[model samples]
Target: MANNTSSSRTDAGALVRYYLLRAVVAAAWVAAAFAIGVANPVAAGILLVLYPAWDAFANARDAQANGGVRANIPQALNTAVSAAVALGVLAALRIDPRLVLVLFGVWAVLAGLLQLAIGVRRWRTYGAQWAMVLSGAQSALAGGFFIKSAAAPAMPAIAVVAPYAAFGAFYFLVSAILLAVTTRRRGATA
Candidate 1:
């Protein structure tokens, strides 16, 4: 029993660290986009592309760690598809306000859904996993707003980018806090 308890604590600690790292990376990406603005479409596209790609890679790594099996194959596939579509859209679009908003909005919704799926699967096992679910929900909501704005002829520069940046930041912030709490819980149990 003691050994089992210790093992569980260790697992919880590892989970916490995982989420914290994800949050930090997310926050950094958002900050970079906000600072750079969308002046350079190529740069913005690169940034947008990298985050989901990084996440897909991370998910792959997690699967490898679990004995050569990716537990969330569907979610992984979704991330890959979403990232691909996002890049393709950005590359093909003409940088008009409407197109840019639609691209970002679509990406956000797809990514959020993937995250939510993963979070739901892990909820029973991980205490702070729900944060990812919340983040996913928020992302979808923000995406909806962006899509609605696209119907308009013109949107402010910030309108297109700000939602993405804000949601990314918020998602990361919540993820970080959840990880911190999970880490603390692990320490207490240990």
Candidate 2:
């Protein structure tokens, strides 16, 4: 019983750190995107590629912190998918903005589903994963919207995706705060 409690607390602390890191990174990325993504195509393209690359890195790191890739199959797969999408976006940017949007749409859908799976799995062990679950659902929905937007005549700018990162930051912030609170409460009881 004591071991489980200690382990749970440790896991919660690690998750809190992960969430905080994600939140900070997302916030900074969104700020940079909004600042530079509208007028400069090159900057926008870089931001587009960076988004998924960052996701890949973040997911891989989170998986490693929690366990091996094998133990975190969803995140591992997400990392791979995000990395592939980053490469695809880099290659497709010269072709068309619509193509880039489509690629992002596909990536978002896959990553969101994987995120949902991770959240569900974590929820079974750590109790306060509601924010992550909602984030995943919203990300999937946003992905469909991105696909529809891509089909429209107007080209989508990188700033258009800033809201997605903003929402991710919000969810990560909430999750981090929730986990921190939970940890504190658990420690106090002990």
Best by lDDT: 2
Report the lDDT tens digits of candidate 1 across residue range 149-175: 878836443436555655665665676
In candidate 2, what are the lDDT values of residues 38-101, reduced to their tens digit?
A: 7778899999999999999999998898878989999899999999999999988988878888
The runs of at least 3 residues in candidate 1 whose Cα sits more than 4 Å from the true structure, single-residue gaps closed, are 66-70, 93-97, 153-159, 186-190
Candidate 2 regions with alpha-carbon error over 4 angstroms: 153-155
lDDT of 1 at 48: 58
Question: Judged by lDDT against the true structure, how good is candidate 1?
Answer: 0.65
- RMSD (Å) of each candidate, 1 decimal: 3.2, 1.2
Q: How good is model 1 by TM-score?
A: 0.74
